[model samples]
Target: MADLSLEQADIIGRVALERARAGNSQPLTVVVLDAGGHVKLARREDGSGIARFDIAHGKAWGALGMGISSRGLAARAAKMGTFFTALAAVTEGRMVPVPGGVLIRDGGNRIIGAVGISGDTSDVDEACAVAGIEAAGLAADIEER
Candidate 1:
């Protein structure tokens, strides 16, 4: 499996921030997590609330831990309701079943990590992640599966 290196993490963070700005979205906090759910990098831009960083981290951590994109989790949450809430509780509130978390994959389609962005609409945040992964010559698991 490919590892999320510091250089790649930096590229992902920078691209996400730039995409957020280009789209005229709110300032964003982007968080990248390795396959083990450890934080590779986290960044909150100026004008973004501090909470965004935590939220973004939660999303990415949740995705890495659960082995699914947060968007998929969100959809599952909608159907599962309190069970999903309980999952958040069970995971110590690290499981953010929201739309911003996305799995990152290498060329062989192995899950390498995840990226999460906050401080804008969830859709916009997800877009930035997808863009960043593509820009880095990687792939988003959402697109693959």
Candidate 2:
């Protein structure tokens, strides 16, 4: 398994910020997590809310923990609210089932990390994450079911 490098994580963060700015999105908070669900990089834009970091981290952490994009988790949560509630409690509220979390995969199609963004609509946050991952020459896995 390949590890996500600091350089790659930096690029992801930078490009994500750029994407958000280019799109005229509200200030954003971006969090990149290693496959092990550790924060590799986190960036909070100037006007982003204070809670954005936690929300972003939760998105990425949930994706890593569940082995799927947060969008998929959102769908699952809708279908199984009780289970998702339990999952949230089990994770100590670290799991956020939403569209902003995206899995990052290396060239060989192996997941190396995940990126999460907040401070905008879930769809917009997800687009920024995808843009950043692609900018870093990695595949962005978004489960939109």
Candidate lDDT values, in order: 0.86, 0.95
User: 22-96 in candidate 2: lDDT tens per residue?
Assistant: 999999999999989998999999989999999999999999989999999999999999999999999999999
* Model 1 Cα shift for residue 40 (angstroms): 1.0
| Per-prediction TM-score | 0.94, 0.97
- Ten-residue region with minimum lDDT total, candidate 2: 136-145
User: Backbone clash tally for model 1?
Assistant: 0
Local accuracy of candidate 1 as per-residue lDDT tens digits, 1-145:
6588878988888898888889999889999998888888888888999689889998888888778899988888888898988988898998887888999989887899999899888899999988887888888875312
Clashing pairs in 2: none
What's the distance in Å from true for residue 92, model 1? 0.4
- Best candidate according to TM-score: 2
